[model samples]
Target: MRPIVVTTMLSLDGVMDSPGGGEHPRAGWTFKEVPFEEAAYEIKGREQEEAGSMLLGRVSHDEFAPVWPTMPEFEQYNAMPKYVVSSTLEGSEWNNTHVLRSLDDVAALKDSDEPGSIIVHGSATLAQGLATAGLVDRYHLLVFPLLLGTGKRLFSTDTPTGGITGLSVLESETYANGVQKLVLDVVR
Candidate 1:
């Protein structure tokens, strides 16, 4: 079975709401605090290159489908297989997109004979669910320096602390922009 990895940009307070300028109250907080650098793009590109498929929740799928397709930088990502977990979504118009009706479907994907990592990006709800289910294998977190006092956090209150124990830090890097990248493996 392939690894199920979750990559997210979060604030110092663990808020993962809007890392890239959105409708959130603390919109653009990430960029406002840390200047964009080549290392950041390099890190993101490396993740995209290593991923065989992307697993997203409805909210993330809707947010990305409209924008990523139009951008030239996301050409490779758009070509990869995308599985969107949603009970309400009937279909997807985006190329290479599939709908997953339940968490069982996600489990099936992980168990599939896929070649590379199944990366989950910007899906806080789905990430929480995966954490609760003890399905997350690794986490790649870009932690920004600022703190957004009120927003949807990466680790919600419902998440049991026991679920995240025994994590082994694989890598820890501090970028030029003050954003810290922490790669952690969940030791089961």
Candidate 2:
């Protein structure tokens, strides 16, 4: 089966929202609150290089579609196939984008003979669903030192793990700028 990886940036308190600017009051906290270190963002380049396709939820798709395509740095991702999991979103104007109606579609996509991993960018709701349904194979997390104390978290009390899910750390590093990179595999 194709691997599904949830990749995200989080704060010390586990807040994962508005790392790169969103509707949150503390949007853009990643750059504003934390120091920018080139080494800290190396994971992004590696993820972009390794990911075959991208998967996003309606919110992230709406947030990224308008800006990512215009940015030259996102050229590689802009060319790859993108799947947006949204029941309400009817269509997409983004390049090579496809709309998936449900998590079942995500499961089918994962079951397909697709090459490389499906990298999920900024989709907390979808990530929670995937994790609860036991679909996420790996996680690429970059945790910053600052804590906003009031944003959407990566893991919450309501997140129901189907069973005892263990995460084995595959790789880890603490960047000079205090960002921690953690690559964890979900042990089934």
Candidate 3:
């Protein structure tokens, strides 16, 4: 089965809102800081290598489809297979991408004969849904030191809960700029 992995940017308070403290949410919270350039590069590279395909929600797909295609650093990702989970999106303008209309399809994808994992990034709602549905196999939360205290939250709803556990601590490291990346394996 292609492992289902989630990679997200979160705040110290466990809030997955805008890391960018300004008007742009989750903007400045990334490794865009001058000191975090090398660290960010390494992390992104690792993530790319670890995943065989990307599963994006509507929001993240909209945001990523426009920008990632233009950035050379993320060119590999743009070329990578992307499965967008969206009910409204009838078609995709991006290359190497397909839209999935139902959450039920997740299980079949997980069982795909893919070489690598199916990774989810910046899809808080979808991530939460996958976790609640007991579909996720692993989670990578990159915690930054700062907090906006409000914005996009990781857990969007409270109704579907109590599906995740058996988290084996995989790796944790503190960066120079206080961003700590924690990788966890969700034991099934």
Candidate 4:
């Protein structure tokens, strides 16, 4: 079985929206607070190397598909198998992309004989749903120092009370730019 890892860039207040420039009011906040660090890229590259596939929600897929394909840095990512969990999307124009209609499809993907990790990036809704359903095996969070008080957060009050999940910190590292990287395993 392959591990489903959810990776995200979050703010101190838990906001994960628009870590890069986008439509959010607090968009580009991460760039403002976190300086460019070669270590960050090295860490991300390592993760990418371990991943066999990439899973994304509709919004995230839409946001990434157009730009990532054109970038040299994302050449490997663009080449990997991409799965988008979206009931509405009938087909995908992106190369090596597949559409999964439901959570059951996601579960099946995890159970499949895939060779390496199935990594998710910037899929806030998908990540939360996976976490709530206890489908997420690990969480790779790069927590930025700044707080955007009013934006979409990683964890919200809407999470089910009885379904609280525990996480074991597998690794933690603080960068020179005050960005903290936490690798957590879901304590299921």
Best by the lDDT measure = 2
Across 39-111, the per-residue lDDT of candidate 4 in tens digits comes to 7556688778999999999999999988998989887889999999998998788889999999889999999
What TM-score, computed on C-alpha atoms, does each candidate reach? 0.95, 0.96, 0.88, 0.95
**Model 3 Cα shift for residue 161 (angstroms):** 3.8
**lDDT, candidate 2, 37-134, per-residue tens:** 89878888898888889999999999999999999988989999999999999999999999999888999999998778999989888888888888
In angstroms, give how far residue 175 of model 4 lies from its true place. 1.0
Q: Model 2, poorest ten-residue lDDT window?
A: 156-165
CA lDDT, every model vs. true structure: 0.87, 0.89, 0.78, 0.86
Q: Which ten residues in a row have the lowest lDDT in candidate 4?
A: 156-165
For each of the candidates, the C-alpha root-mean-square deviation to the true structure, in angstroms, is: 1.4, 1.0, 2.5, 1.4
Clashing pairs in 2: none
Evaluate residue 121 in candidate 2 and report its C-alpha lDDT on the 0 to 100 scale. Answer: 88
Cα error, candidate 4, residue 135 (Å): 0.4
Residue 27 Cα positional deviation in candidate 2, in Å, after optimal superposition: 1.1
lDDT of 1 by residue, 1-188 (tens): 98999999998889999888777887888777678866755667888889999999999999999999999888878999999999999988989999999988999999999889999999888998888877899989989988789877778886674367788999898888888989999987
Answer with 2 or 4, whichever has the higher lDDT: 2
lDDT of 3 by residue, 53-151 (tens): 999999888877877888888776888899999999987888899988877887788887987889898877888888888888888887777765677
Against the hidden true structure, what lDDT does model 4 obtain? 0.86
